[model samples]
Target chain A: QQQVKQSPQSLIVQKGGISIINCAYENTAFDYFPWYQQFPGKGPALLIAIRPDVSEKKEGRFTISFNKSAKQFSLHIMDSQPGDSATYFCAAAKSGANSKLTFGKGITLSVRP
Target chain B: DAGITQSPRHKVTETGTPVTLRCHQTENHRYMYWYRQDPGHGLRLIHYSYGVKDTDKGEVSDGYSVSRSKTEDFLLTLESATSSQTSVYFCAISEGTGGHYGYTFGSGTRLTVV
Candidate 1:
């Protein structure tokens, strides 16, 4: 079973526009939600993350809006640039010493110049 | 940037052959993990090690095994490789457990089983 579901297998946005990606989880035990960005030929890196206690978290042009009741979270990239184009993965994990992350299928974003 | 490195960036092996992928870290992190990436599957954990000689299986550990003999190195081996096993393998490390600190991932190893 896919514990985390991410929508829009692929996306395209014009430069300077907004890029949004959404993810939902079935596991209510999940407390930490993290988004990872991966460039071609590279490994996925941490982009942004949010805790269940917070409804929103923003850093620079990247923001994560979370809804605990809905078990959903979304990533918003403001002023999207070509460099921002990559595969994004949403993952959820429960708080523990050995808990592992459960990831979504991932979404490929393309930013047009 | 996190001092994690995956060796043999790419490999192609015949069916039934054995393959081993190596992950080395210079940061002396306490946790090491191996994950596989596929088209429809984002990333599936193969195995993880909390310390030297202490390891555990992940959700998708079948046909794969891992060993951490030292604090800086973790090895993943595929016994009798199969075509279905072809995928990009990534090695990640974390200073703490439960991913509270997130993880530092290596570039990845592209393995092809023919």
Candidate 2:
């Protein structure tokens, strides 16, 4: 079963615009949510993450808005730039001694300058 | 940064052949994972190790086996390679159960079976 679902298979936005990608999870047991950014020929790097306790998290130009009741989370990029063009993946995992991650299909974002 | 490396960045093997992929880590993390990335499939876990000699299967573990003989090395073996198994494999390391801290991934290994 696909535990995590992400929307917008691909996206295109103008530079300095706000780019948003959303994701939903089926497992309520999930306590941690993270977003990863991957460039071509490279590994997926952690961008930002949020727990069920917080409503939102911001790191520089990237932001993660989380809704525990809705079982949903989103990644928002403010002032999106061309350098931000890449594939983004959203993942969820439960808190425990040995928890595994469940990931979404992924979204390809493009920022035109 | 967590140091993780996947060997044979790219490989092509014939059907019915045996293939082994290696994941090496320098951080000595207790958790290690193997995942395959495919178009429209996302990242599916194949196997994971919590400690030396302790391993378990993930969602998509068919046609694959894993061994963790040492704390720093995890091996993924395909007894009989198949074309359907072609995908980019990634190795990830986490200090904890991955909930507290995110995983650090390697560059990935692109494998193709013909």
Tens digit per residue, CA lDDT, model 1, A41-107: 9999999999988899999999999998888999999999999999999999888878778889899
Report iRMS (Å) of candidate 1: 1.0
* TM-score of each model, paired residue for residue: 0.97, 0.97
Residue B14 C-alpha lDDT in model 1 = 100
Candidate 2 runs further than 4 Å off: none
DockQ of 2: 0.86
**lDDT string, candidate 2, A27-97, tens digits:** 99999999999999998999999988889999999999998888899999999999999999999999788
Q: Which residue pairs collide, candidate 1?
A: none
* For model 2 chain A, the run of ten residues with the poorest summed lDDT: A94-103
* CAPRI band for model 2: high
